[model samples]
Target: MSVAVIGMIAGMALGFAGYFGGFGAFLLVAALGAVGFVVGRFLEGDLDPGEFFRPRDDRRR
Candidate 1:
């Protein structure tokens, strides 16, 4: 249930995907995992959509 354990399992699955389906599969799986992690964080309220898209203030202006 921990993040590290989830990541390890994902890594292992992607490794198998690469072995059977080649580099393209590996990249696809990795991309999917990245997207899933982001979505999960957002849904869990660990990530804020506003903060992600907020503009930075120029202190010198």
Candidate 2:
């Protein structure tokens, strides 16, 4: 699925695990997921739009 959905699921899993086992593991995984989401979004924004749609070379009126 989408990166956001994956991030939420991972965060929930880590949060629950932390609740049951320890705090450090949970924080670590949750932080990782959050950072992944942020970085993924940032990189996605930098992609070339031409990859999605062909460029229009015509410039005449």
Candidate 3:
């Protein structure tokens, strides 16, 4: 499926969770999804942990 479709599904799931389980559930699901994505990228050798914490030149004044 396309990214938009996948995002729409995820958004619907999260909306239901928030409606039935409250704000905490929504936050928990979002955080878990983020962590899972990072882990998957790491496992696939596409993520560099060090780069995440390093300062970027674009951020400097």
Candidate 4:
């Protein structure tokens, strides 16, 4: 599946969610989608959890 197809499906899902499930459901789906994307990236080893939580070593001397 291409990125465009994934985006289209996601858009359609959000549209259906907004049209039928209302704004709250739309937000919930969007948030969950974002979390899922991140988790997927982590699972694929394309994302580094430490990148987000690790403290910067560039502290001013």
Model 4 spans with C-alpha error above 4 angstroms: 55-61
Whole-model Cα lDDT of every candidate shown, in order: 0.91, 0.74, 0.88, 0.94
Top-lDDT candidate index: 4
* Residue-wise C-alpha lDDT for candidate 1, range 1-61, written one tens digit per residue: 8989998899898999899999999999999989998999999999998887666873554
Model 2 agreement with the true structure over 1-61: per-residue lDDT tens digits: 8969876788679878798869887778778777875677668896554555654765555
Q: Best candidate, TM-score-wise?
A: 4
lDDT, candidate 3, 8-61, per-residue tens? 988998898899999999999888888987898999999998888888764766
Q: Which candidate do you rate higher for TM-score, 3 or 4? A: 4
- In model 3, which runs have C-alpha deviations exceeding 4 angstroms? 58-61
Q: What's the lDDT of the predicted structure labeled candidate 3?
A: 0.88
Which of the two candidates, 2 or 3, achieves a greater lDDT against the reference?
A: 3
Q: What would the per-residue lDDT of candidate 4 be over residues 10-56, giving only the tens digit for each residue? A: 99999999999999999999999999999999999999988897667
Provide the lDDT at 15 for model 2.
73
Candidate 1 lDDT score at position 46: 97
Per-candidate clash tally? 0, 0, 0, 0
